[model samples]
Target: MGTDVDIALLVKELCHHDAETEWIEFKTNNSDAEMIGQRISALANSACRLGIPTAYMVWGVDDKTHDVIGSSFRYRLEKRGNEELENWLHHQLTDNASFEFAEDVVCEKHVTVLMVQAAFCHTVDFERVPYIRVGSYTKKLREYPVIESEVWSRITKSDFESIAAKGGLTLPDALSLLDFPKYFDLLGAPMPQSRDEVAHYLCDDEIILRQDDGRYAVTNLGAILLAKNLKDFPTVARKALRLVQYKGRGRSEILRSKDYEGGYAVEFESAVEMIMALTPSKEDIIGAVRVQTTAYPERAIREILANALIHQDLTVTGSGPVVEVFSDRVDFTNPGTSLVDLMRLVDNPPRSRNQKLASLMRRFRFCEELGTGWDRIISSCEALYLPAPKAVEYEGAGGSVRISLLAYVPYRSMSLRDRVMACYWHACICFTNGETMTNKSLRCRFGEGGPSSSTVSKLLATAVGDGLIKPVDPETAPRYMRYVPAWA
Candidate 1:
């Protein structure tokens, strides 16, 4: 499945493995179509059961002596009745089974190889009966119920990120498909002088796996994080961030939209820059020149965007992270609900469905300190005297999480739910800082032009009535009352 160089290396490597291995079969010139189909099913199932990514069948090698004797097996010219050898075998196997055959000259002899992809979501079957390799012998899967069960269990626990997004790549193709420079730059390492050295690093990181055939397999994690163009990998292409700008606050009217086609690491900065450009800003006069300041802090937007990409549930097909820019607020929505309690997101340690993605992004400096993203978003908003951001989880069909960052809204115009949420988030921030929320502090949160002290006090009372916050000391005077999050 790789280049000629790959085939030569593979032939040499296969000679080293024990012929009794379940995932490998060696032959000198046997070209029986039916037997080959059965071997394909057996090898695929065995590979899956053994946690191997690929299975192999090599021709032109002595099974006992592992000698490089040329074979007359020309799979491309063979026929099964009126059907081509490859076509007939493909039709006999289950839809989940995949294989390819290659013929090349290696060790000065004619060599042939049949490469089979391991069964992933389901066991491979030929002729409507599953088969598996047992000590170099092919047998019916039903004869071994325990192995069948184990294969099913492995399928059930398979990780989407670990699956190959695309396979059968040469060294140059693999390097060109990913933003290799960005990857090394993120780690603050200089690019290696040799391409193979670069590949060594990628393989060590589990980004690109070196197949037994000397080819490369680009994993879903690598493609999602570093692919030069996501379109090259169909599985993760739909995972790219989609940004939509509305003429107003609702979705009915469309202004403009864009779907970033690069990997998360490659397009993160551009996505944030686009959002900031669409964000509402106000002009403020200083001593000399006027400065334009965005309503939402750039850091807050960047952090939330990164969170969305890192926390999204990759199992949810056909959906990805989305950014909706409205006149008054920006919403960052991903394809999964929060793993932690909604109320505890600010203080709880970070939990993500894609820990590998999160860890890599953190290493790239795209993420805030572990568990401090929400804290930073909250603190940034508070510094601008802006209404607190809200994190909501809509549950169902693997659920979803949406983080909404609001622009400045007057206290009087804020709905009761908005006011209560603001109070709760404010208390959460104060509690996280080892302090408690107070009337004067709440007033300052709303800025000097906010309503009177009594208005802030009434808002705090509403939050308490809603059980989102509680007085730190019940016996304290009303003027000196302080509050912490209800759970705190």
Candidate 2:
């Protein structure tokens, strides 16, 4: 069993199963390094072939009786060659292939569990040979030509989003399972009066496909974007969005939380509304009237939320896109790391892991077309005089992409880094528009038009000193000088 209590329960549950599945295997106290490596490779490949996220190799359990017989295996401390066992395993496996070993005590018996992530986009190999699990036995993949071919096809040809959420359902059942009305509403099409017509519409969109058996298969795309209740489809319920609000700057103080369960299109509006309500706002007095403005720009928040939803990795189980609100900022974190470099987010074309989902969200007007969302967020923040939002990739186990929208901070209160970043982003935007950063433009960005030109020059010089921007013509007169980002 692993360090997590849930993993311990998972081990017990697997042991209770009548037999080992294609993605699950049992091992005794045998800790032969080569054998363990081969098993890990086999489980990983088998899991990919079976379209599962992870495969399990549980120790301390009997194969035949399915009994918890305790394992003395301590592979973590074992060594192969001059390297540790884990390091040796890593060197043998394909790129991005990973596995974890956990130790626990169950009912006074020591147990070790190995959790292997499925090979993705490539087949996993050990000692220059790919292995797979056939029933409960591990063997060289090429030994079974038929299975080898099938596994390779699965690896090279399959798209997770295109997989059917629920296969072999009747036309009526498929229609009943999804919210056709909302789909039509989002698409700006009138609802069909008949079930047959609705089924035809869904089929046309590839949401459901007609099978030879006269049944329909609901694709993951359809279920995730328009399912009546995402929970009805077990594989996608974890993809639902969760919103949490804290009482203060840290998470120690709890306020409120909600896990949105509706489809993305159905729940997006309400989720945004809830977030805006929880977000603090200020009262502004115009010349003759009063206005209420939120702590963060609504348009920027909407774009960030949509990006998180459409760009998340649907295959990651156990977690999904999360919106966490603290006193000073709102954080958007999704299950997968960004496809594009965080530093290039402002100028690079948007890259999404889920292209189909992105296309649909664009069609529904949930987000803009490719590459414009970040620009919009930046410009919106600039227009509001708010600090530019931050985008970063949190690197670790189950890595994620996070975007934070900081609360409104006056330009006088901004830090040196903040000023440099704002100037750099302003230059990026200007260069994108075929212009250059000037003292006047920089002053306008900070809403400090009354400041002397020399004062503005100091800010620009500070940016240049930090190597964030450079003068286009160093010898040009100060009054005629223009600047661009250092990389530009």
Candidate 3:
């Protein structure tokens, strides 16, 4: 429906309220920008206290009789000194609360409505002072310390996804800004015939919130996953995934780099494809023809990239997930330390800082549904006889986790640490699949050109000596012995 029709319905609903509310004010030709600013703060704070998502001030309505009389107010044309009224109010508000004005004809009279989102994360302040509504009167928030504290407490507990990325959008504006068709396609649902049904679905999925003023607000979840251009949402524009290709194994010489501008889901496949394309590959003769082989398995790369995006801390500002491709390794780093122990990721249940983002990515089949992502990466490495990937966590404020996929290294040239890690990861993968690592299995992972049986045994002994893996049965024959992860 058009904005005009929606505005008319909203006006009717507001008129039906039995009494004037703390969250709503009726005025006629009250064009004072300073007074409007105070009401905005008071109404926004009151809405939070009452657990309401939005508050409003409507003009062209009779204050006592609730009648829609024609208004002479022209908010769009109002100016304070040299600045527009809208811009001035925005600069004066402390909470960054999104408030917008919309004008339409209601009851055959011109009516203007100002919609204000409730205080979230901070109390709304105008001109350096906070305000709140008390029995329909606007008063300084400091005069009511108890109410101010309650607002702060409630605001801090809000979910990150509920925060507005962009506000005051009409249905058409929202549809144009987000890739709505792709959203339904990912969910495996047929498109609804009516536009209203589409809007309802988006709101139900928490992608967009329907406002009291008949406008729409894009949630962080919606913008992160479906925005056509992330730049439209300034709060999350910098959260776009980054990919860098280096000339060698260091950050000094960057070969190529890109910052994906679209939402994660929209740009995911293309990003993976680009990463694999930049990956080093060689030609190998298989039976009669030469086949191309990549330094890392494409399956492993996909899982790693998806995990980095899904598990990242969305609250972290200024940084996002990054994939760096060196000549010898690919490192996937994201802005959050691992919730699962680095050593036990193969067996631990999946934990994510952004659960909603993870769930949606899984629904779209971009990542694993079970906690087998790490297991698959390990197994793929074993299949190709490549060295096992390493996962490390950096702890502290602004800490992050990085997982590196290394190129194949000759067994004779591998370091002791590399050999021990290979054994531990093999045991981990085996234990996850209800099996244990044996000498023969370990040798198979090293391929046919690998070391002798005795050499493999020595490596296993070294791994055991380093407390990386333990024998399942110490009493078992040397040739028949099986090893499992030490923590198993």
Candidate 4:
């Protein structure tokens, strides 16, 4: 059905759902501007607090009387200098909250629908304060213990750019640690000759904001995009890339660990190249000549790195990006959650928690078109004949988001390229010597359990035929025989 039918049906059909409360309500005559605004805030904040993805307020419907009376208000009408309604509301809001107004014609009656998407956070606070309504009344959201805590957590910004540094940092002190040259280069703007002019430029661009005192303070934007050391910026420093190489499988037996940090504009390309170096490499046979190849696909590496950089929560304190190399699949996870729906991540456009952060980072070429990052990653995986990447959003108990990507193994009937991957993973699994390669294990590893033992054997046999895998035992051996990664 259309939006009109869907909108009405939601109130009727979904009304019976367990979590469904009075998420949808109506009002007619009491349309004072500020009061209406407050009601909007109350409903929006309440919807988020109540855990509903969205809430609606319709005009021309008697809220208490439940009578349908068309509203005369013209929601589409705008005044001078108020062209962007959403932007205007966002500017007024202490936090970013998304809402839409639609005038639907139901039985020739016009209804103004004010719909709000629940904050990815706990509460939608206005001016940094969560306000709620109770029994036809409104009050401080903090009046309720549970709801209050959630609101504080949700509305609070964890991004260093949003968070003020301890005591206040001096401009030069912050600049001393970062590479200023990288900033100007990324902007393609001519650098002012004077050092003080550069500081003012950074500050004016919101890269740095000086304190009330004579000294200057670098914004999180400054620290991340231009920091000499991200570590100095406590909120986001840990977000620097971290790599852990294991001798066998899990990260328990780590051989090396390093944090990737530098100017977001200057450091990303180098960081990605360095991390790729730490991963496995292969020798490709091209026209009778064997050429070395990166064990993990470069696109896969870049895609994950960009995902890490762009989608991270930046709110969770001390959390950063981590890449754990396993004998089988490589795991890369960054702190933060996808702003878009989990299932829709690959297909949908990107949504960011910190839009400003996203905007500045985009200037540095750190991300592809918003919402297209996951698609690129998937395409990259398929191009290499690797299984489609397993992308996921992890919700920690404390309410943080972490995105993960698992490298795919190659097998025959999958891809000639995947066959190469299967060899590497199978051999790598065998190299562990503890877990055996079996049909179930292979299925579980690939997230597909439909294939039987015979099919798995053929697939493994194909890998062995290519000398990509050397099974540790006979074909009849149980799932205990471990295969080493072909590199070993």
lDDT per residue as tens, model 1, 237-318: 8898899999888899989999998899989988899999988788999989999888899999999999999989987767
The CA lDDT at 412 in model 1 is 82
Off by over 4 Å in 3: 1-157
Q: Where in model 2 is the C-alpha error above 4 Å?
A: 1-140, 145-150, 285-289, 448-455
TM-score of each: 0.80, 0.72, 0.78, 0.52
lDDT of 2: 0.81
lDDT of 4: 0.58
Tell me the lDDT of model 2 at 239: 87
The TM-score of candidate 3 is: 0.78
- Among these predicted structures, which one has the highest TM-score? 1
* Pairs with backbone N, CA or C atoms under 3 Å apart (clashes), candidate 2: none
lDDT of 2 by residue, 1-488 (tens): 11322445556766767888878888888878899889988988897788665577888888888888898788777888779998988888765455778777766778887877667566789878899999989999999999888888888776656656655456777777787798889989998999889988888877777753355667778888888878876557788889999988999977998988878888999999999999988899998889998888899989999999988877776788999999989999998878887767777877887877888899899997669788888888888787778888887756899999988777777877777788888888888888998998988887743345787688789989988899999999999999998888
Q: Write the per-residue lDDT of candidate 3 for residues 389-414, one digit (tens) a residue.
A: 98988877678999999899899988
Which 10 consecutive positions of candidate 3 have the poorest summed lDDT?
A: 1-10
lDDT of 3 at 45: 84
lDDT of 3: 0.85
Poorest 10 consecutive residues by lDDT, candidate 2: 1-10
